[model samples]
Target: MLAALIRQAQQAGLSPEPGFAPKELHWLAQLHSGKFTGVLPLREGKKGRQVARCPELSQPEMMALPRVLGQTQAAHFLADSCGVIALLPERAGQEVDAKTQAKHGAYAALLERAAQDLPQLLPVLEVLRNPAELAELRAELAQRGAKATDRLSFAVDGLDLLESELWYDWWRRFRRQVFGQPTTTGTMLDLSSGEVVTPAKTHPKLNKLGVGAMPTGASLIGYDKEAFSSYGLQAGENGAVSEENAAAYRAALEHLLAQAPVLGQMKVAVWFDHRQAEGQALIDAIENPATLTQASETFSWDDWDDTEAIQIVQTPEQQAAVAHTRAQQLLSALRRGETPPTLTAQYFALAISGASGRAMVRDWHTGSLEQLAEAVATWFEDLAITNLSGKRAKRPRFFSLLMNIQRPKPQSTSMDDYLKPIRNLQLPLWRAALDPNAPIPFSAVAKLMEAHKAQVMTGQFSEALSRDGDGEDKSRIYTRMALLKAYHNRKARRQLARGQGGFLMSSSVDPHHPSPAYHCGRLMYLLANVQDAQGSDVNAGVVQRYYGAASSTPALVLGRLTRLSQHHLAKIAREKPGLALTLERDIAAVWSALGHALPKTLSLEEQSLFALGYYQQLADSVSRRQDLAAQRKAAAAQADPHPATSPLAETTQTEQTAQGE
Candidate 1:
């Protein structure tokens, strides 16, 4: 049956090559001789006999048939066609020859069968099955046979065995063979022209099968072993090499190259463990100097002009021009009584701005002189009432205003105690006016004028009186007035003396007259009456000044009272010689109180002088009183000659004289 099938296939234009051997032929002859049955049927149900077997053979013959065939052919269609007879195992050692013949024979038989069954397969068969008709096919098969000398080669050669519909269609159109011989494919084929050239056919199965035109001695051209290993390909694996793996490797290479530009420029010292050939290939492909040059050309400045220049130098004349322009603008604004935007403008154009430049503005507005004056005047009026009480006045209102005005710069650090309160009030008021809502009291304003008067009295006053000439004049004037008022009021009040007689006698002017300290108290009383009658004139500087002066009178009067106490002690001592002892004790009590007050009252220089005089006078008076007391006691003890002559009476007279002395 196999021989008859071979003959039938050959008759139908299938070519049987001489590669067939004795064993394969014998296998076919046995089938023709009815020595074996075809295949066994497991179940007895369907067609013909109850125990179905080959029609021309017995059960034993059919059983022996499988044993006669080799495992390779037994698994394939060796007995089905004579064209495939050469593919059966004829000799144990000729594996390569047998396998190649088997593949070609199978293709021949398939083509012939296809031609007979489907007329559409005729053209493809004419080109592939008959060596006489398709010389190229015969040559390709021979080339494939020569190449398939090893396992890898055989696997590659097996690619031609793909007998699918698309392969047949490709065969019909191009009449080209790519199985063994190097024929055109992949960009080389002109499929549109129907030319017998290699077509660019990316065969999915061929790629998956890893069947290339030839075994690339070192694996498919750019196959990455490591990548293939990731896909389960190890050192030794069975079956055909997967074309999918090859394609995957190619795709991976393309991806790497696409990312090369960015990676190449990265400052990473990449290292890899690869076979020398692979490493070298990667280095050569990625480290091309030409690529770097091309990349760098993208930013080269070929069209730039180096000779173009710019001038940076500023001339003295130009600078002077700028200064003059600024000066003129500032002067114009100042003349309009407008405050300059900045201190620099104010200072440079002060002369041209007139009084406006020097005018006191609030400290919140940068503390100009005008604002300080206002604050001082306001605080001075507030301080007036306390200073008039004929008691030592507590200048708490002045201290509070000073604290407010000085803010960050303490007044004590910058001004004398006499002038500090007034200056402090003025400075912050100047700052306060910069913001309209900021407080600027009438008392501070009044004190400002008084401070001006105080400045006039002090020799420390500046000659820069005109605000237009110098920016500091108004500040200086305000400072001076505050100092002058503080000093004048302080002196005037000191002239009034409070005593048992309502006021002390002033012996310097009139021995029997009341002291200027007493008069100061009267003046203060009169000023209080005037203030009570007139409502506080918030705008009047004169009212504030007089009020400040009158208020300070009591402090002066208290100081005079202190001095008067010492004076009376001296007068009593001079008037009663016998009472010197009593006088001395009273005087000592007065002196002790004065000693306690003196330190606080006197300036450093005055304190030293006064302490020295007080101690000196105290020592002299003590010594003289002691001597007078001793002399009187001695005389009383000597003899009363008239001795109603009680020793007790004598002693009593002596004691009385001593006590008087």
Candidate 2:
């Protein structure tokens, strides 16, 4: 990761070499150095005195300072910056002096040192020479928005002093000469750069830890507690990062924190690097995954000035199809072994979470672009489901897919334990989507079942049968169906090792062969349809009351439902004989496949199959309705002046679809 960050810095034309820092740090260093020259305000008593045109530190140019005890460093505006009394060594919240001094010569020596080092610092020296002059300078600087605690610098010759290479070099030398090596004893291994170098006392704080965190930032390598250490190494030495390498890595991570988008509590950053290092365009494309699908939408043709013209515009559906097409193309390239070294890229992703005043490393992954593209292609393929009209389902956003498995929130403010179970399910599911070979979590189906039961009971079954409804409602169904499919397909593969599984399910219901539970699910759907055919109010329908029981324990619920559905079928036949026969035929086909018997109870795996079967049967019912409606329209259009619309031609349609399908 450090190497990648260093590479990033170099690619952006930034030099974080021995004498130079990264761009932001360089700018900050310049803002605090004293070589800069600009308009300098005089003391309050000297208000009529012309503003000095010399090196001067202003409060607005300052940054947060590092804490250093028992040492004093004076800025260009030494007297102008108040709060120096607290930093003076001779004072400890005591009276200022016996008689003459209000500040008791506070920070006097520190100001004098600056004057002795450079005569250019005369303005500050003059102010410190007189107590009244210092008081006035403080008052004047305060009125101009100067803060006593802020680090101060100046603008010299129309440029920042720290921007001068001479000042950076001088400061580096001064620090080494004055402080010596931080670790007095021995050299240690630098983990980030993989070299032998003196380790730092602590890694620099990750600048701007921006997940709604305190700006004071966090430690990436902390060994403050004894249990956190090993082999007698103390503090950050346990991680053993050299001060230089630590700074570089922190800068890089800070860059990502500023750039990556945060979703929920996960902070994610991604980058694609090439071995030959010539993939700027590829990196740009990889950064915006949506662009992979909707390039024309993001890269507009009308606004484009490229030599090649983009003349065609595609609809959202077409954009989705195009994404799959591109994914497949990438896979085919790998399969054909047509990829060159230039086509190869390395992908890195870091998932971070900030909590407890520290940056937590949640996940770090590296993969080849080819592998990622193939996995993504398979992801979309595995997520595909059959809609109510027996057509392919559109791809769902990852966010919506994860949200479907999550239960509704608690009313109470406290829910930490409740959220852990949900988070456990989410992490593995996310990994499964990325690495196709990774197992779907063992808890996935069970948790989804829990959420499914809640949905059925809460009257949120907006599209329980039709499969496709309106926008967001349809998306939820599609995501649920996709997650179900992925889990089952993976479960089936695992079962193949025991010689207990043979094939995946088709998009529609299979009557030739199926588990008993699946057949039970089909029975449940038919019973719900029976209720609808009789125009019974579905507010307390068969599904609303008994879907959970019927799916898990068929013997207890199926028989009672069958008896109730027969009564419903009798009523439907009286009103619409033709529609009733159609319903009876559908039920009979499923029963015949079940060998005219119901299972006593279902196992856990069987329950999943039951859910899928119910969804499939519901979709088939919707397709049949659509086919019937189309047929009636055709007949009405061709018949002699519509022939007064005979009752036979006008078989009653269930306006009250099952569960509001």
Candidate 3:
């Protein structure tokens, strides 16, 4: 039986590759089992070679060579090379031609049946018969004839056909296969009443079996040639019945409508139009009456005067009022922790005759109708129920008031206008606290206090107070001066407590005790500080004056002068006072100190500020003395001419004495 099977497979165009012959049916059995593996020689041109040891033979290629050669001498040669025992030709129940014809008839019948209900089934059936799947199908069909007629059986057959390797091979061959060729290895056949008509030899590239061609044996089974030609399918053109398809498609549409409540007490009507026109159908088979009515009406903006065709529900004035009321209500609801509901249209219509015409009812529901009603309700409910007992809401305090005072009003007249009125009034008092004798200029003091207050309020005073001279030397000097002035005020208050009232003494020339060297050093430091503040090189006279003054004065006075000069220089530097007057005063102070012994080790630059200070002091003293002399001369002129020289002088002396006391 196995030998007979092999013979039948051979005659039916089955063969194996070289170096793959059967031994006791091993090669034939292995080939049928799909497990045999070997190389097959392939050569171009006329070079003969062993079929084994070929570089280009894939496993499928090797397996297919024998099948292609069939029971011919080529099959025997290929089988010999592969070392497989060849099956000799033997009658296997029927002649090859007869068997081939029967298979073709079967295929033709399958194609006809596929074309009737589902033309998609033909390609699937072609797959089943290519690789001996017909045998299994035939056996299965024979055992279950009733089951084979069911849709599930067709699905199973389709899946099995797709899974088979023969399916892909047959699909390729079907595209290339020709009719009336005896050697064509496909099952498609023609069954006709007339003699088997031979096809004429035309262009090899022409696809005669394609749709719309004359009905050859292969084409006649699944399609009508006459009808295809009339429809232009055979003319290699598209059919002109697309509108018909659309009409048919539209007739099969289904409409879905939803009616739901949106908000708490309003109804929502939603109409979904899913109807489609199939083929050439102009109208949707399943359209809603309301939508169709609306679509049929023509609208024109210029037809407002046609009152019978255009009725107004709410006039423009009424609409504005309604909109305003709605806005107010929405605001009130938000304030009262309530969710606002949406307002939807009450009616819809075809505006054919007038806007007042009764609308067609498409869908209707009496329920809640707000867009975000649920979301709004949830938000308000969450807010009302949240537990916020221990959470402290921040409130403004005294510090906020202070900050508000310092902040400048936008349209101020000047710096004075910008400063708080009370702060401006306190400037003199602040300066008096620093030094009674060295009362700062009111404007300069106010500016300084404002800056200091800003720095303090910003929490920068402590850090500024702590920093010494690093790279920022000028800032260090300013910080030191501010601290020292603060210290001097404290010391003066302490002195006043002890009844030693010298708080108003001149910082330049006080003579009670030997002044400390640190005082002279501080004065020299201040001169340098001021010069640096002015962005200028040091002048010698300025340094000399301070050094000489420090040498003559008591330590207390020296210390006071040091602190005072530092404060005053910082003030002057920041204020940029009139330099002429300042320079004169400084020069006069240096000149007055010149009456004392000078330091031998003083540098020329160090002597310059002192010289300048002496000149300045002299100029001021002369100016004052000259003014006094002029006043006396004027008084004498105003007196009686050459009269009462002795008695008048005595009366004047008595009055001066009483006034001085």
Each prediction's TM-score against the native? 0.16, 0.68, 0.14
lDDT at 415 for candidate 3?
43
Q: In model 2, what are the clashing residue pairs, if there are any?
A: 30-162, 36-155, 36-156, 37-155, 37-156, 44-136
Model 2 Cα lDDT, one tens digit per residue, 1-661:
6677656555544334332333221011111133222225323442222221222211211221112112223333232223442222123333333321322243454345444555544444454465665455444444554433333333333444333443443444534553454555448777767777787766555644655344556676676787756577777677777766665666567666666755445566666553212112222232333444332212212432222222333675554454343444454454455542333467776767666557777777778755666566556566778876668776665655656775656686345544566665655655665676666765777777777667765656534543435465565665776777777766666677678975566556667645777888888888777877643323235687888888778988988988888888888887777778877888998888888789888877678778877877777777766665666656655774555656554444323232123
Worst 10 residues of 3 by lDDT: 274-283
Off by over 4 Å in 3: 1-417, 420-491, 495-503, 506-623, 631-661
**Error of model 3, residue 236, in angstroms:** 98
After superposition, which runs of candidate 1 have C-alpha atoms over 4 Å from their true positions? Answer: 1-96, 109-119, 127-131, 134-287, 294-661
Superposed Cα deviation of residue 364, candidate 2 (Å): 3.1
Question: After best superposition, candidate 2 residue 513: deviation in angstroms?
Answer: 6.7
What tens digits encode model 1's per-residue C-alpha lDDT throughout 529-642? 222212111113322334233334334433444454455445545655544334445434433433433222323222212212222222233344345555766775565555
What RMSD, rounded to one decimal, does every model reach? 45.8, 10.1, 40.7
- Residue 350 in candidate 3, Cα distance off native in Å: 81
Q: Following a full C-alpha superposition, what root-mean-square deviation does model 3 have from the true structure? A: 40.7
lDDT of 3 at 97: 48
Candidate order by decreasing lDDT: 2, 1, 3
**What's the lDDT for all of these models?**
0.29, 0.56, 0.28
Q: Provide the lDDT at 395 for model 1.
A: 27
Query: For candidate 3, lDDT tens digit of each residue in 238-345?
Result: 222121121121111100101121111111222211101110011110111111111212322242221121222378555433333332333234445554433331
